[model samples]
Target chain A: MPETNKKVLILSVNDEDKDIVFRPADTLLGVLRGKLGLTGAKPGCLNGDCGACTVLVDGIPMKSCIMLAIEAEGHKVTTIEGLINTKTQASFIKHFAFQCGYCTPGFIMVCHSLAEKQPHADKAVIKEWMQSNICRCTSYQEIEEAVASILAEE
Target chain B: MIPVDFDYYKPESIEEAARLHEQLDRQKMLPLYYSGGTEIITLLRLDLIQTKAVIDIKAIHECREHILGEDYLVLGSSLTLTQIEERNAFPLLTSVSKEIADHTARNKITLGGNICGEIFYREAVLPLLLTDSLFVIGGPQGVKILPAHEAFQQTMQLGRGEFLIQTLTRKDFLGMPYMSVKIRQQWETGYPLVTIAALKAKGEIRAAFSGLCSFPFRSKRMEDELNRKDGTLDVRMDRALRHIPAPVLNDIEGSAEYRLFVLKNTLTDILTVWEVEQNA
Candidate 1:
């Protein structure tokens, strides 16, 4: 791979921040999985079609697969693993929102971002926002209900 | 899919980016300038765009400012739809942007990328058409401000390679009603059969319809009929409905006739609402 000293500072919500220099060819996903050992962000559909690799870039949900590591420099990034709250995690278990749990991390990340940005969003808007992430196991109904319940309580 | 090996450069400013483009050999060096990589990544993955260098323009500070001035509203090229929605600077545009897929897609997609890439079923283009927005393009020659419609026309004619710096619209252009109707099997990745935008003011209607032609087209004949003294729009609508060519777009998703019918229905619906608002 061609080499260039492109340093990126990743400020995770957990205070586990790090600054690492990457090559121009490295994607955000590549650096996260290969170097950082943060495997919560699943590598599914490197293209932007599937939102399985969604993450919060500067408080906005984005597909980490398509973004270059260098593009994320000077921006705050929050991944799925960093989204666990004592309350929400308890509610996720109480509501039973996961089936096989493969796509749970992405959903948690997206919902966390949405809740932070728009906690008052209605069910229709939440459904509209969740359309980007596809789940093959048909667990969206439960996921939708859980998200709505959480928002309703808050 | 990983993109082919290429040199990457992030310019510090828009002027520097423009100068970088000017220095490159236009023919020999295929430099692709990108603000956001939502659409460009597809081309890069397919190896359709064989460029020696990819210039990232997000580093330019001027490209990210959203200026709500007294006379005009200027949206920097790199401004994301999410930013626009949060600010509520442009309500109609924000409504349309929210309707598009989800937050993730909106974050990666930029206003300049949407206009420059010319993605079909575009919500921004329709609202822009209704408001008569102008695009500020910075090229090797100099900066040129072209009407939004003319910008799309010129870009569609010449293909892509120009840098869109910002989009500007007059603040006085108010009371314009813009609406979009799309029938999709699924909300995400669902293509619209037809999209119509109507700009009605002072009993005058300037309407445009997409999915009825090669690109979005103004219905001057329909507009004229709406403006006529004895022209009750109910009867004019019947005539206008017929003039809309059938099956303007035929794809796997929908037929041309179906698109025409949707376009007519959409126009009728929006015009009725517009008339009610005008009368109220």
Candidate 2:
């Protein structure tokens, strides 16, 4: 055991830099939900198969479950809690995109990143990007409609 | 979350990383190189792999190299699949990477991580194999460059304390007529039933495959048979099928027979499309 196992991570979550102690093996999702009490990013499948733990790291959508907390030390992590009064949220509300809501945070995070990164995303591009998250509670139609409605703004 | 605690080091240079790995191995620490950490996190949570030290190589400059050289394209191992796809320096690679996982996972799954991953469906290596790219490996003996064909046999033959830094592919093969197709068992996202990558170079077709056998491979014999000028497309394909490198895989995604069936159709389609391009 080397002396570098425990680390004090200064993570920039939703634009605020917070300090916390974490082990090298601790995942970002665990630290966020347990230590920070930011439970927006749901933990559905610990595996990367389900994108239920997706968050934006440096403006890129990344599954927090698959990412080590220590790795996010210098990057900006934008969780679902970070988003407020955005077009994506408004569109999701108007389109009735979510049901049961277990996967909404992850879906919203991915959708927000997509809208910010590729605002003019076409049908094919939208399908490709949004395929990252899985929402089994409701039909994919409403979710796609929500994303499409926001992308239409650009 | 992973059940065990391990020391993590982010080395800024390749030599420092190699030295750290050697030191950790010498101390019986069971050191492992960490990149994207996607597969590592998943496997660690299941207690499938254990390590006392993790050397994070993502900070190394060499592992972050992504450049289009004068005659080659140098891509670092730590570059995420989405980054590669967005750059589109290599169309065949972009196509293969686009189908590896979903977009979010790709944002985390790095090139080297996928190539040297635990999962068998290493579709990202297909294009590198087709182009005979150069694999830059860093180890205790310093850096060594080997052709991808030589470095990869069923899987990357990396020695202890050795890690991939980046891959170099000749620019000539970058723009070659190539086709990358991954046929999933059910939908567009799951593991491939059989993924085929074909590149037409020097008026001859070169090909590689994944999910067909136990490991991804580029069979010279199969390519030779497929490139034979005397036989019709069917005849050549039948002969090429005889040269499959190993017994086809029979896994939950698909049975071996079904995989071969899909593989044959895919190979035929690729050949037909390339033939039309050649005629045009």
Question: Highest lDDT, which number?
Answer: 2
For model 1, residues B1-280, the per-residue Cα lDDT tens digits are 5567556678877677777766653545577777777776667767766766678887777678798998888888888877877787777677666766566788888877766674655556666766788878776766788888787651332224458888898876543555555554345454566656666555577776655665655555767775665767667776776565333778776777776666666677777887787789
Q: Which stretches of candidate 2 lie over 4 Å from their true place?
A: A1-5
Best by DockQ: 2
RMSD of 1: 3.3
- Residue-wise C-alpha lDDT for candidate 2, range A82-149, written one tens digit per residue: 89888888888899999888898888998898888989888899888888888888658999888888
Q: Give all TM-scores, in the order shown.
A: 0.88, 0.98
Q: How many clashing pairs per prediction, in order?
A: 2, 0
- Tens-digit lDDT string for candidate 2 (B186-263): 878988899999999999999999999989999999999999989799999999999998999998988999988999
TM-score, cand. 2 vs. native: 0.98
* Reference contacts preserved by each model: 0.42, 0.82
Give the candidate number with the greatest TM-score: 2
